[model samples]
Target: MTSIGIYGSLGRMGQAIIEVAPSLGARVAGGADAQDDPAPIAAKADVLVDFSAASALDAHLAAARAAGTPIVIGTTGLSAKQHEAIDAAAQEIAVLQTGNTSVGVNLLARLVRDAAARLGGDWDVEIVEMHHHHKADAPSGTALMLGEAAASGMGTTLGEARVTDRAGLVGARAEGTIGMASLRGGSVVGDHTVIFAGQGERIELTHRADDRAIFARGAVRAALWLAGQKPGRYTMDSVLGDAVLGA
Candidate 1:
């Protein structure tokens, strides 16, 4: 059985991962969060999974390094500098980072890419997402990622084509623009959809995250898959098979 470290052990997702430990063949060696140093607990762990705040990453990385533990980071909202830090640390240790952990979400992103690659630019692409009111980010990292997936497939960059949520009487939807919209309310975990609109018909692909456990399960699966990987930056796409994603 793999001994796991749950950074942000007190948070909703962390506790949820711990709750499903048995079925995944894992044991919580220890954990840490903003309120406490998971070091005391994480010391015994073999793989450290950081799901804590982006702010706490420095401490988490230091501790994981000292423990000689490979790390899997699930925290989103990281700046370019923060990503630099994570990438720098990966030179000395293994690190897996993802904007979202749901296998479905990653697969959805790949599907969006495939569709964009097959369809002409005339088929406008748009993304919509809904999450709990507590979420801080406007677009939700997953939404932006999906947009990036489509943009990448079309041989362009997202920054150039993105049409974020609109206000006022925003003119008409521009051709070739990848639009993004967001919704917040109640205790929603997450929901995402991508629409490909063409002159003749439209296609929609959606993923509804009814519970946070789905994410936790994906994280655990990623951790296990990373256990034997060569030290480097990794994503959920690498953990899951190509048969499911086709990319």
Candidate 2:
């Protein structure tokens, strides 16, 4: 059995991971959170999975490195510098990181980009995303990633085309602008939709995550899959392998 250690034990995702670990034929050796260090618990595990905040990634990665354990990071909203650090750490140990862990979400993301590309440049692509009220970021990382994929598929850079949130005085929608809108409400887990709007016809690709456990399960699955990969930086796509997408 693969021994798994979870970082961010007290959070919702972390608790879900800890709860899901046992049934997946894996053992939870330990976990870490704001109040504590997970190194002691991680000492007995073979891999570490971090579902913590952006601020906690450094300490979690440090503990995993000291223990020489592979880490699967499912946290998002990290800056470019932080991403570089994670990639560099992969050289010493295996690492897997993903913006969204729901298998269905990953699959939908792939299809959205492909559809955006196939639909042609004339179609205006806009991403509409919503999450729970407690979320910290304006555009959820997943939303931005989806937007990036859409822009890339159409041979454009998100930085050049992204128009997040609009106020008054904006004229007609700009051509080629990858628009993003966010909604935060009661307890909604997550929702994303990419709309390809054009003359007479429209296409929409959507994914909704109702339960947090789905992400927790996917995270555990990723940790298991990462154990077999060679030491290097990887993504959820790598862990999914032939399962790179799900319907």
Candidate 3:
């Protein structure tokens, strides 16, 4: 059985991973919280799964790198600099970082990319997402992930095509732009919808996350897949190939 280490042992996602790991034929090698050192856990496990805060990413990556261990990152609310760090770390250790770890959400991203590519520029793209009230980020990372998918479909980057805010007198929606909106309330696990509106019709692709366990399961699956890989960056699509994704 694969031995998995966890970087955020006390959080909901971490707990979920621990609960589900055994059923997936994996055992917890060890776990570390915010105040603890992760290097020890990284040293012993076959792979590491991180669900910790973005602020601790560098340390976690460093620990994994030092131990020559593969790591799966499911943390959200990351900045450009943090992504750069992950990219840099990938040069030495296998690292898989994703905004959301739910298998359904990753599949939705694939579908959004395919639809955006085939729909043409005349179809306006918009993304809306909601999470629990305690969540800190606006325009949750998953929203941006979907926006990136839509933009990629159009052969454009999210930076160039994304429109995150709209106010009075903003005028007509810009052609080919991907709009985003974020909502927070109650105990919502997560809800994402991608809309493609054209002249005569509209298409909506949605994914609703009802439980955190789904993410935990996907993360563990990803960790197991990543354990034996060569050093490089990866995504859920990499973990779930075209056959599994039904692509």
Candidate 4:
């Protein structure tokens, strides 16, 4: 059986991964928390999964690199510098980092990309997301991921096309810019909806995650798939075949 290491052992997503690994034909070799050194677990396991805080990402990435073990990072709220670090690390060991790991969310990104590409620039793209009150990040990682998809569909980067805030005197929505809004409240697992507004008509696509298990299960599946792959940056689209996605 494949042995997977957990980087945020005490957190909900980590616990969920451990809870569901058995049914997926994998074993949790061990895990580490914020207060512990992750290298020990990294050295022992065949692959590692990180649902840890963004603050702990560098150390975790360093540990995995030293061990030459493939790692899947599910951490969110990362800075641009941290993203640069992931890009640098990908050259040495296989790295798969995603805002959200749920299959539904990833597939939603695909659909959003397709819709945005075909709908033309007249369609105003807006993404909205919500999560539990405990979530540290606004515009959950999943929200940014969707934004990236929409931007890509329109042949642009999110930085150039995103509108994250609006205040007094804000005029009409700019053409070709994608807007984002985030909500936080009681125990919501996750909810994301992408709106495509056009003249006299609108289309909205959405996905709701009711349990943490969906993310954990997808993470495990990604870990298993990354085990034997060559060093490079990978995505959920790599794990979920495009043929299946196209169907």
TM-scores for all candidates: the values are 0.92, 0.93, 0.97, 0.97
Better of 1 and 3 by TM-score: 3
How would you encode candidate 3's per-residue C-alpha lDDT over 1-247 as one tens digit per residue?
9999999989989999999999998999989998899889999999999998999999999999999999999898899999999999999999999988888899899899999999998899989899999998888988988988998999999999989879778998889898999999999999999999999999999999988999999999999999999999999889888765552
Error of 1 at 141 (Å): 2.0
Point out where model 3 deviates above 4 Å. Answer: none
Cα lDDT of model 2 by residue, 33-88, tens digit: 78686678667788888888898888888777787889988787898888988988
Clashing pairs in 3: none
Best by TM-score: 4
Q: What C-alpha lDDT do the candidate models reach, one value each? A: 0.85, 0.84, 0.92, 0.94
Residue-level lDDT tens digits of model 1 in 175-213:
888999999998999999999999989999999999899
TM-score, cand. 4 vs. native: 0.97
TM-score of model 1 vs. true structure? 0.92
Better of 2 and 3 by lDDT: 3
Model 1, C-alpha of 164: deviation from truth (Å): 1.8
lDDT of 3: 0.92
